[model samples]
Target: MATSVLSKSVLPKVPKTARKTSTKTAALQAQPDAHEPDANKTLNLILSRLDDMKAEETVTIDLRGKSAYSDYMIITSGRANRHVGAIAENVTKGLKESGVKSVHVEGLPNCDWVLIDSGDVIVHVFRPEVREFYNLERLWTQNPAVAAV
Candidate 1:
């Protein structure tokens, strides 16, 4: 005959003290996630503001020590000529508002790919074909752990 639910044998239990320690350890593990700097979050906010201003395919690559350019490379796409110009403008405005200065911007006349060189971060706003042709991620694939977001 099959055992009734109430008659089933229970597994060995963790001691009360060990259970408390495990719970505390789990809480500690959760703590770091809560207070993390969230670099991606900040990047996304900037990208959203860029998108709100119609910047497309916005991607950021963490390039720490990979190149002298900056710690991060942020790339975006602009659907058309005018959109590229607008994307540059909005990025500049947003960066300025965020207390970032000395932004060296280029490539607006053709609207092919505008590069905004901030000291610690480089933002590239590009036309789709230009971005696809260059394939920057392929060039930097050695550091794949650093995501382009």
Candidate 2:
């Protein structure tokens, strides 16, 4: 003889009032500023993380007026590839835990130079040789007059 099996029942409908309030709450939370920390706060958080990770030659270049991409560009060096990767990983994790919604990372595999873009702040973690070769601080902080002419 074949046995009959019963499926689970459907969920009860949500009350309209409950649904409306939840939808409104979600909409309010979806606003960009509602969740984003202040740009300066985020920058400081990143800097502190880099320091804690023992990143060397840390330099912060103001990119507010110069670049539309980010408000600040931070360049720092690590003793080696492993150190570079660790610095990048630590900074990325720190930013996320500190309420940063999104963090983008690149060049982590080789660890020659790792770049982390955390909304308002952009951080570069590079091996000493890589940092010297790129010289990002000089490039970004150069005098506009000198660069133009």
Candidate 3:
């Protein structure tokens, strides 16, 4: 069967047995980083999963008005090209399974920057350099909520 995007939010306080198998993630965020970990709990759940799965730079942009694509833009980085691709694939699959319906995805072959457009959310999987060069969070800091942070 042709694959579809899956998107589902994890339920409250539930610790996933399939913990992030990445030591790097634990090192990166020893403390609870980022804002709105609860209000955007779903997005945060995805981030934690992706992070546990070795995805880096896991950021969510609240694009409630900044963009029409969705209320949030999630960005993450992979250790390498292969890792980046893997993160994108997992994210796409997860979204589809969750019934999120990934309308489109791009930049898989290169893996430098993969864009998964899943209606309400757009996921960006990028290499560290690529993420730094783009600095999406900086550009998206216009939101009052994010700006306050």
Candidate 4:
């Protein structure tokens, strides 16, 4: 006789372990949020996650009239390559958990700079030297026409 296809041995077992929230995240949740409007909920979530990860020199640019792609662009520097990757991953995870779908990400393997694009926001995580070399904030904030290029 042939073995049963629906046998218990053929099925994968799943563990029922309880999940614990991280101390950092719990602490952040306890703090009162400086209320931004409903339109900026996603933006606030990303910013908080970046803060939790210790991302530095964070700059937020209002791209409301400037770019059709997203309403906001956030540029932040991580201490190093690993930090950049971690920051990007954290932001992406947060976006997904917040029910934002179709988030796009790039540059994770290189880790010198990582870009996360949600529909409403774009985030750049870079190493200090890499951020200085690109100077993306200057392009976007200083000259609108130049940023288009």
User: Which candidate number maximizes TM-score?
Assistant: 2
Stretches of candidate 4 exceeding 4 Å from the true structure = 1-39
Q: Model 3: residues >4 Å from true position, as ranges?
A: 1-45, 142-149
lDDT of 1 by residue, 1-149 (tens): 35654455565656787656577688887774443324454465567778698776667777765665567778788898788888888877776666564668899788898888766677788789999998776667654544333
Ranking by lDDT: 4, 2, 3, 1
The top-ranked prediction according to lDDT is 4
Q: Which lDDT value does model 4 have at 85?
A: 92
lDDT of each residue in 1-149, candidate 4, tens digit only = 24666666786765544256778878998985444223399899999999999999999998888887789999999998988999999999988887786789999999998989887899999999989999998889889787665
The global Cα lDDT (0 to 1) of model 1 is 0.72
What tens digits encode model 3's per-residue C-alpha lDDT throughout 4-93? 222233334446755555787667668654432232544654676687678865877777766654668888889899998888888777
Model 2 lDDT tens row, 35-69: 57778998899899888999999998887777777
> Which pairs clash (backbone N, Cα, C closer than 3 Å) in model 1?
56-77
- Predicted structure 2: clash tally: 0
Q: In model 1, where is the ten-residue run with the lowest total lDDT?
A: 33-42
Q: What is the lDDT of residue 87 in candidate 4?
A: 93
lDDT of 4 at 18: 28
Per-model CA lDDT versus the true structure: 0.72, 0.84, 0.72, 0.86
